[model samples]
Target chain A: DAGVTQSPTHLIKTRGQQVTLRCSPKSGHDTVSWYQQALGQGPQFIFQYYEEEERQRGNFPDRFSGHQFPNYSSELNVNALLLGDSALYLCASSLEAGLTSTDTQYFGPGTRLTVL
Target chain B: AQSVAQPEDQVNVAEGNPLTVKCTYSVSGNPYLFWYVQYPNRGLQFLLKYITGDNLVKGSYGFEAEFNKSQTSFHLKKPSALVSDSALYFCAVRPHGGYSNYQLIWGAGTKLIIKP
Candidate 1:
């Protein structure tokens, strides 16, 4: 089965602009979670979508939002992007919303966003 | 609040030698710990997880993690290191017995480099 896939492997944006990243969850998976990975840091949780509804969110501000389609694909939209937003945006997929401790998450290749 | 700490920024080891990446986490209730590996410019890959039962959890790519409840630590280990194993390692944790509402808190990541 094909793993999680993300679109626009690389993107360049300017300050105050907007950008959108896309993700297709792994086959048979229904939950999608977005994460931001800055250089030399681990991925940080942005938010999660299940059943076409946002189930949880991290400390990110309102500028960052996401959508999950019925097909389990997801899109992460960022408004008023900043230089700090230049990082690898990762998408992870799991089988369900409430995962057991042993449930492993599969991640996409991620979209590298460069803000000028 | 949940948090994870990767004590080392980088770890250097010789091929054929055992390797260990240390991680500690803090969260309310039982802890759901996970380890993921990331190659350069790629998304994170699932390594292993510790929910309950065995303290030593084996996962993909010959990786294993020992969950120490008393110490609140989950350290990734391999019997022998390989140059191919060199990559960024992350530790994450979420509260147990909770819905997907709890986000997975991640560490700063540890870079492992194995020399020939």
Candidate 2:
């Protein structure tokens, strides 16, 4: 089966503009989570969606939002993008909402966002 | 709050030599530890996880990680390094049990380089 997939492999946006990145979770997965990875840094969790509702969120500001579709696909939206927003946006999928300690996450190729 | 730290910014090793990437974590209660690797322009790929059971956990791509509860450390190791294995490695942790959300706390990442 196909792994998690993300759209807009590369995107360029100007400051003050908004952008939306899409993701299709792995087959048979339901929960979707978004992460942002800046240059030379590990990914920071943005938020997680389950059952078409946001289940958990990280320390990110209100500008970063996400939605989960019925098909378990997800979209990450960032408003008023800044130069700091330039990073690799990754999407991960898990089998369930309340993950056990052993639950593993599968990731997508990610979308590279460049804020110009 | 949960957090992870990859002490080394980068590690260099020769091909055919063993390699190790160090990681330490801080979390309330028991921690679920994970290791992920990211190639250039790609998302993070899950390598291994430590929930309970054995301290030494083997994972994909011939990677293995040792979980040390007393030291709060989980170090990734490979028997023999290859040039193709060069990439950014991340360590993450999440609290186990008792109202713990499955949100992961990530480190800044460590870059591993294998020379021919």
Candidate 3:
């Protein structure tokens, strides 16, 4: 059973440029969530996708958006990126429980985005 | 407001010594807590979770957490520290009843260094 997987382990972009990070959830998982972790900080919730629709979002702006494919894979798109966007973008997957209170999220290696 | 806090920025311990990473949380109702670890340049790994039963929850890599309802704390503990166990430890809490899209509230993270 493969765990969550992400692509483009590292990326570089300049301010105002756009970037897309990808993630494949673990087998048998139906929900995907995105998070951003800056240096020396804990991860902040970005948003969560369930049944191909955004079920919940955090305090992020409109520039940060995501999509969940039919296969349960996900993509996080950041538009008009800024230097402050340089951080580790993490993707986590979990089984879709009616109540996620007990769900444990499996994470991928994450993409390191460096916005210059 | 729901939140998690890792008061210590970093913790240093000698190999073979037992170690503990502190975490405290505040939420409106019963708190669903979790512990995750991240190695250098890697994604966060689920260590353990606390839901309804068992105040002491054991997880991967011989990690365990004790949930104290009175103190509202869930502290990660290891029997013996290993250099390989050194990593960034994070504490997270699921909002009461997972009503808010199951987004997790995270702490600032604590860097653990096990000296060999």
Against the true structure, whose lDDT is highest? 3
lDDT tens per residue, model 1, B15-109: 99999999998887787888989998888888888878989999988889999989999999999999999999999987777455446789999
Runs of candidate 2 exceeding 4 Å displacement: A97-101
lDDT of each: 0.89, 0.90, 0.92
Candidate 3, A30-111: lDDT as tens digits: 9999999999889999999999999989999999999999999999999999899999999999996766447788899999
Q: Candidate 3 — which residues are off by over 4 angstroms?
A: none
Candidate 1, A1-116: lDDT as tens digits: 99999999999999999999999999998888899999888788899898998988988999999999989899999999999999999999988736553456789999999999
TM-score of chain B of each: 0.94, 0.96, 0.95
Measured by TM-score, how close is model 2 to the native structure? 0.96
* DockQ winner: 3
Candidate 1 global lDDT: 0.89
> Lowest-scoring 10 consecutive residues by lDDT in candidate 3 chain A?
A96-105
Best of the two (1, 3) by lDDT: 3
Stretch of 10 with least lDDT, candidate 2 chain A: A96-105
Q: Please, what are the lDDT tens digits per residue for candidate 2 over residues B1-116?
A: 56788999999999999999999988878878889998887788899988889999999999999998899899999999999999999999877778848778899989999999
Give the per-residue lDDT of model 3 (tens digit) for B45-116.
899998889899999999999999999999999999999998999999887663564888899999999999
The clash number for model 3 is: 0
lDDT of candidate 2 over A1-116, digit per residue (tens): 99999999999999999999999999999889898988887788898898999988888999999888889899999999999999999999988747463668889999999999
